[model samples]
Target: MAAVSPREERKARLAEAVWRIIAERGITAVSVRTVAAEAGMAVGSLRNLFSTQTGLLEFSAELMVERAAARVTAITPSTDAVAYALAAICELMPLTPETRREFEINIALIAETPAHPGLARIRDHAHTQLLDLFTRIAAMLRGETAAPSPASRTNGRRLLALADGLGLHLLHQRASDDIGWAVDIVRDELHRIKSAAIGD
Candidate 1:
């Protein structure tokens, strides 16, 4: 991989500052000046990376999705399909402080989608990427090596909905019990798929 440049690093830090602001003060509080203050930089410096507030918001949302995609890509396949699926899906949720901040930022950007075309495009891309990830997980649950079947596609959509809903729940209700229950639900679904695959 190529080394991260100083300019890119500063932009990422600015994005992090934007997310922190969103997590603490809501989306209305994030501005170039506020983000620069949070990042300990000048507003002009932030503007060098993001010409406008919309650009900053788009970059931050894209960064969050990219991080989640990187996490999913890092997973090594294992024999236990249920465990692996749970792990992969969990990568997209607010399970940790970093991830929680990302989720919060994502939610903030999503709320502004109507005002920002760039954010709307990012949302669409994220939805498609998530469906693709879930489809792969569904195929794994069904013990398939080739293309996903129609049933598998349906199951994938269902799993994505369940996981996304669980993520929203966890965003507001952050508790160990909630996380455990969510994981159990996904595990049960994957197990059911595996059993059905065996029967077939």
Candidate 2:
């Protein structure tokens, strides 16, 4: 991999500081001063990078999406459609510490969207990407090579809803809790969708 530039490294550090503040103190605690302090940078220096708090928060949200997208994109393509679909879906859930942090940051950013309208665009973009992935998964499960049929599209929406609901629930669960049940729920849903597609 290529080396990270100085500016990119600084931005990444600042975004991580934003994520830590959101996870520990809440989004309301995220200000230029607090983030600068957390990142161990002077206030004036932070200003040089991020002129406003909104810009900082927007970059943080965009970084979160980029990180999640990278993980999903890294999944190895599998010959088993169900296995591939499950792996991709599970990557979105807060099953591990890294993913949990990502989800926390995601939820915080989403809640602040009403006040920071800029974040809504990032959120919408992420949602569209996820929905497209689900549509492709639906097509794969149905053993189709062509564009997704209307039924596959509907099933894709259903799968997305299920994943979203489960992810929210998992966020509230304790770290020690056995999340195997949640994975099973996703597996069951995938099987049901696959069966339905086969029937159609």
Candidate 3:
């Protein structure tokens, strides 16, 4: 890969600062000047990188999905289907500080999508990709024998919803250990799919 220039790196830093401020203090804290302050750079310098708040937010939205895509790509599937499914679901959840910030930033971007066509496209793209990801994970859990049935597709959607619910609950400061709740839901569903595949 080509080396990133110093200017590009600074822009990435500003995007990260926007995410951090959003995660801590909501989108209300994310003006261009405030983001520049959070990034410890002059407003003029930040403006040189991004001409407007919309441009900065678009960059932040792109960065948010890029980070999640990288993590999802890095997941090594497990031999045990349930474990594998759980791992995939966890990739979409806010289990760590970085991922938590990611979730927060994505939510903030969602709010802007209505007014910004660019952001709306990004949000729509992410939705489609994540649904495909959930479907693929469901197929993996279904294993080699059976074809993917409509019920299986529905199950995949349900799993995606469950993961989103878990994320929202966690984001709203639910118990730290409530992740177990998510795991239990996935494990139960995967077990049902596995049993069906085996003619149980």
Per-candidate RMSD vs. true structure?
Answer: 1.5, 1.1, 2.5
After superposition, the stretches of candidate 2 with alpha carbons farther than 4 Å from their true spots are none
lDDT over C-alpha atoms for residue 173 of model 2: 85
| lDDT-based ranking | 2, 1, 3
Residues 1-200, model 3: lDDT tens digits: 69989998999999989888888899878898899899999999999999989899888888788878887788786777787677767777888776766787788889977777888988988888888778777777777445666766776788788789878888887445556665677678777876776772
TM-score each candidate. 0.94, 0.96, 0.86
Looking at model 3, how many pairs of residues clash?
0
lDDT of candidate 2 over 36-114, digit per residue (tens)? 9999999998999999999999999998888888888999999888999999998998888888888888988999999
RMSD of 2: 1.1
What C-alpha lDDT does candidate 2 achieve relative to the native structure? 0.91
Task: Kindly report which residue pairs in candidate 2 clash with one another.
Answer: none
Global lDDT of each candidate: 0.86, 0.91, 0.80
Query: Which candidate leads in lDDT?
Result: 2
